[model samples]
Target: MKDPIATMKSFNRQFQLGKPEIEAVEWAWPQEQGETMFHIINVYTKAAQFPRLTAESGYRLQRVGGMILGMVN
Candidate 1:
């Protein structure tokens, strides 16, 4: 699909150290089909601000009897 949203959602892969999963998406611009757009995934923008937010949430590291909690995803 040529749709940017679809391409982004299809990218369910690890990015860096945190293994952050993009569960939800919110864009500042109106997303219209067949409309040319410029998308930026950067720390300066909210679309790319998930990592810092998740980190600040203070998720606990779960350790049990060989059952590790997966924060990624």
Candidate 2:
């Protein structure tokens, strides 16, 4: 979790163009399982010649009774 901006910069370097400009980064704990999560919002330039806004989130959850439960969008 150290230097998240640096991580985003590295990720943007992997693309030739249409690099996403970070808008915001939010940290939250929405579950009782004590898992840390992060949400990122950004805007990508030159995507189909138009700027596109996007939001992404990442987290890890445990499995119960051999069933994995999580949500992604």
Candidate 3:
């Protein structure tokens, strides 16, 4: 990965707001504690797909993952 934050931002950018399917998926996720677990799964999936990611990029992903985990906690 070039930049994890950038990757996440790009992923989010691709997200279509106001799309009922996405909203429904989000709503389907379990509340409260589930968000952190979900983001951890997200980061793991990203890492598995992009194993050659740069150090800073990986760090950024972990950092963001941590932030997400914190917020969800």
Candidate 4:
């Protein structure tokens, strides 16, 4: 996808890489020892997409499967 920030894994990788734009991260609760922890990473618009996106630019999710990330204006 043109906007790498459009997906959960990509955004998580960004967070692991210390991307400053990551606003916050949400982790699945009820953590169990040795169990995989799921995450929901929140971030603002992609730097490359910020300029091109607009209130009128129209919202579009590159994908519709799984737990899709949410968008805000």
Per-model TM-score, in order, reads 0.31, 0.28, 0.38, 0.19
Q: Per-residue lDDT of 1-73 in model 1, one digit per residue for the tens?
A: 3665553443323231233334323332233233222232321133333444454321211111012112222
Clashing pairs in 3: 1-53
Per-residue lDDT over 1-73 for candidate 2, one digit per residue giving the tens place of the 0 to 100 score: 4554454345344432232222211111111112221221121211212223343211101111011112222
Task: Order candidates by lDDT, high to low.
Answer: 3, 1, 4, 2
- Of 2 and 3, the candidate ahead on TM-score is 3
Instruction: Mark the regions of model 1 whose C-alpha exceeds 4 Å error after superposition.
Output: 14-20, 24-45, 50-52, 56-73
Off by over 4 Å in 4: 1-6, 17-71
Predicted structure 1: lDDT: 0.29
Which 10 consecutive positions of candidate 1 have the poorest summed lDDT?
60-69
Q: Write the per-residue lDDT of candidate 4 for residues 1-73, one digit (tens) a residue.
A: 3333245446445334223222221121112112211222112222213333343221221121112343321
Q: What is the lDDT of candidate 4?
A: 0.27
Ten-residue stretch with the least lDDT total in model 3: 24-33
Best TM-score among the predictions, by candidate number: 3
Error of 1 at 54 (Å): 2.1
Each prediction's total of clashing residue pairs, residues at least 3 apart in sequence or on different chains, is: 0, 0, 1, 0
* Candidate 4 TM-score over all chains jointly: 0.19
At residue 8, candidate 2 shows an lDDT of 37
Error of 4 at 19 (Å): 16
**lDDT against the true structure, each candidate:** 0.29, 0.24, 0.41, 0.27
The C-alpha RMSD in Å for every predicted model, in order, reads 11.9, 12.1, 11.6, 11.9
